[model samples]
Target: MSKKTVELSFPKLVLIIATTVFSFTSMSNAFYLMSYAAMPWYIVAGLLFFVPYALIVSEFTGNLGQYSGGLYSWIDHSLSQKAAFLTTFLWYSSYTIWLASLFMKLWIPLSILSFGQDLTTRTASFWHIPQIYWLGLGSCILVLIVVFLINKGFFTISRFMLLGGSLIALLFVVMAVSNLILLVNHHGQLSQPMQQHILLNSPNRDYQGLLGNLGFFIFGITAFGGLDTVASLVDRVGHNKRRFPFAILIAAILITVTYLAGIFLWGASANWAAIFTNQKVSLGNAMYFLMFNLGHQLGGVLGLSSAGTLILSQIFLRLTGLVLFWAYIGLIMTIAYAPLKSIITGTPKNFWPHFLTKENKQGIASHAVLGQGLLIIGLIWLVVFSNAHAVNLYNNLTLMTNVSRSIPYLIVAIAFIQFRKQQHDYQLIAPRYANLASGLVITTILSAISFSIILPLFKAHYLESMLLLIGPMIFSIIAVILYHHFNRQIELS
Candidate 1:
C-alpha cells in the first residue's frame, strides 16, 4: 500500500472553525427565542448548558487528533463499534433535517416579503404554488451547480460563508447594542427590565421548572452545533494539533459575547411584554423595530442604515445557509453510500471500509456526492408536496439536526470520562477548569436537558414526539445487537 497525504494552511483551519460555528440556522433561532424568553437567568442557563459540552468536545478533539471517521471512529475506539454506528446514524439523521430546514429559512423570509401577512394564513390553497417553494428550489439548484463546479478543486466556500456570516452577526450586535445604549441614555432606565423579571419569575415555582428552563437554554448552547465539522476536518488544519484549541476558544468567546449582547440589546430596545405574548414577532423583526425607533431618535439615515443592515444580513445569511445545506447533504450522501458499496460491489462487509470509502484528491467523495445529490432532489420534491408551514418546518428541521448532531458530543463526553477513569491520565489541557468528575456531571446534566427539552420541542404530533425520543434509543439497542452478531460472523468466516 502507498502512503496517503493531505495538507492545509492555518487560515483555512480558522475558516473551517468559523464556518462550523455559524453554519446552523439555529443561531438565529436562538436569538429569536431569547427575545421571547428574555430572562436574565436564561443567560446563566445557556452558559451551564453549552460550556461543558464545548470543553469536553475540545478535549476529545485534542486527544483524538485526525483519527479517521471523526465521531464514528472516536466512538468505536472508546466504546463498541455499535455505539459508533449509532452516533453516525444520529449525526446523519440530524443533518438530513437540517437540509430540509435550510429550505425553510430561504422560503420563510422570501415568502414574508413577497406575500406579506397572508403567507402564513394561506395554507392549503397556496401549498401548490407558494413563493418560497419556488425560491428554495431555485436556490438549491444554484448551490448544487456551484458544488459541482468546485467538485474538482479546493473551494473557499467556508471562507466566504464565514466572512458573510460574521458580518451579519456583527451587524446584529451593533444594531442591538446601539439601540440599548440609546434607550438607557434617553430613558435613564433599561427599557424592558420588568419583562426580565417576569421570565425569571415564571420558573420560580419549582426546581424542575427552573431546570426545564435551563434545559430550554440548551437551544442556545447547541447554537454552536457545527463546531464538529471543524473538528472533523482537523487533519486539514496546519499545526492543528497545537493551534486548533486556541482557535476554538476564541470562537467560543466570540459566540458567547455576540449572543449575550444581542439578547441585552433586544430586551432594552423592545416591549418585552408584547414580545413574550406575540408569536408573530421574530428577532429580525425586533431589530427592524429597534431601527425604526432609532430612526426617530437619531435620524432617518441612521435608522435606514440599521434597517438596511438587518435586511442585508438576513439575505446574506440565508444565501450562505443555502450553500451549506447542500454541503451537508453532500456529506450525508457520502456516508450513506458507504454501506451500500460494501453490500453491492462485493467489497468485504466490515465495520470500517477505509480504502473504498476514502475521498478523492479534491476531498470529494464521488459516491457520496452522487448519493447526496439524489437525496436532495428527493427532499426538494417532498417540500414541494408538503407545502408545510415554513417556520414550523424550520423549527422541526433544526431540532432534528440538533438531536442527530449531538450524538458525537455524548460520545466524546463518555469517552473522556472513561479515559480518565481507566488511565488516570489528567495531563491533557482542557479549555475549561473542569476535572473528569465535573465534566461528567456537566455532561449528564446537558444530556438530560437535551432529552427533556429538545425532543419535546420538535415533536409536531404526540405520537411523532414520542417516537422522536424513543426512536434513536431503539436504533442504538438494535445496533448493539447487530454488531455482536456481525463480529461472530466474521470470526466464523
Candidate 2:
C-alpha cells in the first residue's frame, strides 16, 4: 500500500469517524440517555437511526467523491435544486443555532479551568440583568480570538483539536477503567443497580406513563443524532469503496457500543439517585462530575488520605475542564467555518454572492467566517437580552438544533435512494442496502416526530416544544425569502 493509504489505515479511519461523531466530550449525552434508564429504546434508536445513517453517508461520500458540494450536491443530483436549497438551509440553520448556544456556554469550561468549577452562575450582572450579559460579552471575545486563529487555516488550528481529542479520550478511558476497578473491588455490584423495570420504563418517578416513556425514546433518538456530521470526514479514508464502508461500519458499531457501555459504566461509580439528587450535578457539568467522582473513588480504592483524595478529584476536574476548554476552541473554529463552507460549496454558485463565497490566501472563506462570527455574537446578545431567562432560551435553541439536525439526514437518505437507483455500478451500495437505509431513516424520523409532541406534556418542556415548532417555520420562511432573492439576483445579472 502507498504511504498515504497506510497512514489512513482501516483502524485509524474508524477512529477518526468515531471520534468526530462521538467525542469524549459527548458523554454529556450519556447522562441524558440514562436518565430514562431505557436501554432498549436507545439500542433500537441506534440500530434504526445511527447505523443506517452511517451506512448511507458512507455510500454517498465514498462513491460520489466527484461532487464538490457534499450534502448539497447529493441531493441536487437526486432531487431538485429547490429541494437541495431548502434542505441544506435547514441543516445549516441547526449549526447556526448551535453556534449561538455554543458561545455563551463555552465560558463554563473556561471558568472551571480557572476556578476549579463553573463560575458563570456566580457571575455578577451589569444593571438588573442576569449573569448571561457578562458571559455573553466574554464569549463574544472568545469567538473573536478563535475566529482569528481559524482564519489561519484548518491545519494551523487543528493542533488544538488533536491535543483536546487525545487528552479527553485518555481521560474517558481512565474513567471507564477506574469504574471497572471500582466494580471489581465492590464484588461486581453496580453503583446503581439495574432494575428490570427500568429496561422497559423510565426509572424517574417524576415521569411515568406512555408519554414519559415515549419522550425518553425520543430523547434517545436525539442523543444518537450527531453522527450525520461525520459524513464530511469519510473523504479522508483510504480505499474509498472498501476501507470507507468498513471504517464507517466499525465506527457505527463502536459508537453504539461505547455509548451503551458508558451508560452502564456510570453506574459502576455513580448512584444515579444520589448524583441526580444533588443540585450541583446538572446536565451541563455531569461529564466533569463523572471524572471528578471517579478520581475520588479511584483515590479511595488506591488508599489515599482525605486531602489526597480531594486533591486527586480536583485534578480530574481541572484536567477535564482544560481539555473541554480547548475542545470548544476547535469546535467553534470548525462550526464557524465548515458548515458555512459546505453550504456555500454544496449549493449552486448563484445561490450566494461572489464576495461571501470567496476564499482568501489560506483558501479560507474569510468573509463568511467573519460574517458567521458576527452573527453568533449578535445571537449571544439576543439570548442575553431576551425577555425569557437565558437558561430557558439556551435550552430552546439546543432542542431546536437537535431536531433540525435530524431533518437533513432524512432528506439525504431520500436522495441517496435516488442516487443509488440511477447508478449502473454494482460496486457501490446495492439496491437492497439503499432501500433498507431509506426504510430505516424514514421510519425512525417519522416515529420520532409523531411521538416527540408527547415529550413536553410529560417533561414540562413547553417552551422548548413551542420553539421547536416555531424554529423550523422561521427557517423555512427565511429559506424561501433567500431563494427568491437569489433567483432574482441571478436574473438581474
Candidate 1: tens digits of C-alpha lDDT, residues 106-224: 44444433433224324343467765556557756844654463344233433343444544445555565566666656575555564544555442222235554554555555555
Give the least accurate 10-residue stretch of model 2, judged by summed lDDT. 1-10
TM-score of each: 0.70, 0.89
Q: After superposition, how far is residue 226 of candidate 2 from its true place, in Å?
A: 2.9
lDDT of 1 at 394: 44
Can you write out model 2's per-residue Cα lDDT over 1-493, one digit (the tens) per residue? Answer: 0011113555555654666566554455445435436567668888888888777777776666445456777788889888888887888888887887777777888888788988787757679876767777788888788778867765554455455555656766877888899999999988778777666655565445766666666767776655555454343233553566667778788878877777778788877677666677656887887788888988999899999999989988887888777767656665565566567777766668888877767666678778888978877777776767765766676676666676787798788777777753423456667788788988888778756654665568787677767777778788889988998999899
Off by over 4 Å in 1: 1-19, 22-43, 109-136, 139-143, 146-154, 180-188, 194-199, 202-215, 274-279, 282-358, 386-403, 421-461, 474-493
Instruction: Give each model's whole-structure lDDT.
Output: 0.49, 0.70
